[model samples]
Structures are given as C-alpha cells and as structure tokens.
Target: MKKWLLNILQCIQDIYQILKEIKALYNQFTIVTAHLQTIIRLIENYNHLAEEREKTVDTDQHQREIKLLDIGQVMKILNISESTYYRWVENGELQPRKKGKRHYYYLFDLQDQIAKCKLKGRL
Candidate 1:
C-alpha cells in the first residue's frame, strides 16, 4: 500500500511539471506571434508611405506648366467659399476648371492673383 501511494504521488508530480512547461511554451509562442504581427504592420505602413512619396515626386516632375489645386486647398489658400469661388469663375475674375462637378485652380496663376489682391488691400 505504501509503495502504491508513492508511485501515485510521483505520477501526479510528473503531470504537474509537464503542464507547467506546456503553459510556458504556449505563452512564449503567443508573445512571438504578437511581435511578428506588429513588425508586419509596421513594414506594410512604411511601404505604403514610400509608394505615395514616389508617386508625388513623379507627379511633381511631370507637371511643369500647371500645378493644380483642388477645392479644399483652394479654399484654405484663398479664405473663400465654393459659391464665391464659382461666382468669380463665372464673372471671369479667376480662371478655373469645372469638370464633373469638381473645381481646380491653376497654382501659379492663383498665387499671382493672391499677391495682387493682397497688395490692393494692403493685407
């Protein structure tokens, strides 16, 4: 009876040690997986930013005669609303493009106009 009890205790101790080791291994695997995922996300974000930068540089190179500014940029630069901008266009005050309900302004022309207007206003 004493021998049987000793063997049973030994078996329980062995199982406990195995379970502890398995839990530790699982924790380590999870940590490694999380770290790898974070690295992949960082790499993907960097790649996207690099591609965007390259495209922007290419656009800058090819566009020499005219640089275009979309509506939001126009408003921010001129401090005006869409209605006023369109009216100016219609009255032939500021030349612009109206294509598919989107307006675009020529960058260099707009800058010249802003300078003249600021000079007149002493602003």
Candidate 2:
C-alpha cells in the first residue's frame, strides 16, 4: 500500500510539472499571437496609405498631365542635376509650385528657362 501511494504521488508531481510547462507554452503562444496581430495591423495601415497615395497620384496625373513637371521631368528636360535645380530655385531663376512635399514646375516656366539658356549661350 505504501509503495502504491508513493507511485501515485510521483505521477501527480509529473502531471503538475507537465501542467506548468503547458502554461508556459500557452503564455508564449499568446505573446506570439499578439505580435502577429500587431504586424498585421501595421501591414494593413501601410497598404491603406499606399492605396491613398496611388489615388492622389492618379488624380494629379490626370489634372496636370501636360501643365506640370515634377523634379525628375524638369531635370530630364533641362539635363541638369538636382543641385543645379535647387540652385536655380535659390537664384530666383526657376519658380516651382509646392504640393505636399513635392515641387512642380509649369511647362511655360521650363520653356522660358530654355529660351533664357539659349540667349545666354548656355544651351
């Protein structure tokens, strides 16, 4: 009878240890799940921002297709570097419109710059 009780007590202790391990695993799983949820939320927010940007770009493109030139377009048209562009802006040679964080120039302004360059024998 004594031996049988000792065996039972050992079995109970083993079960308790297994329960503690299970509890630890559950806590870890919960933490992982929370992190995954946060990641999912961040991705969703990024996607939403991307979609909004696409819509804004599409609208701007449609409205300013031929009238407005972005920095890259202006650079390509003038064959100038970014530093030169900013220098021109600083010198009051080129006036650009600001929308959000981007700068846009009018097609007429670019034509004027080109004519000035030709007159100065720079182009």
Residue 5 in candidate 2, Cα distance off native in Å: 0.8
Tell me the spans in candidate 1 whose CA falls farther than 4 Å from its real position: 65-123
What TM-score would you give candidate 1 relative to the actual structure? 0.51
Q: Lowest-scoring 10 consecutive residues by lDDT in candidate 2?
A: 59-68
Q: lDDT tens string, model 1, 17-123? A: 99999999999999999999999999999999999999977765665456678978876677778797778788887877778888787665576667866877733
List the lowest-lDDT window of 10 residues for candidate 1: 59-68
Write candidate 2's Cα lDDT for 17-59 as tens digits: 9999999999999999999999999999999999999997887
**Could you tell me the lDDT of residue 1 within candidate 2?**
67
Off by over 4 Å in 2: 66-123
Backbone clash tally (model 2) = 0
lDDT of 2 at 111: 72
TM-score of each model, paired residue for residue: 0.51, 0.53
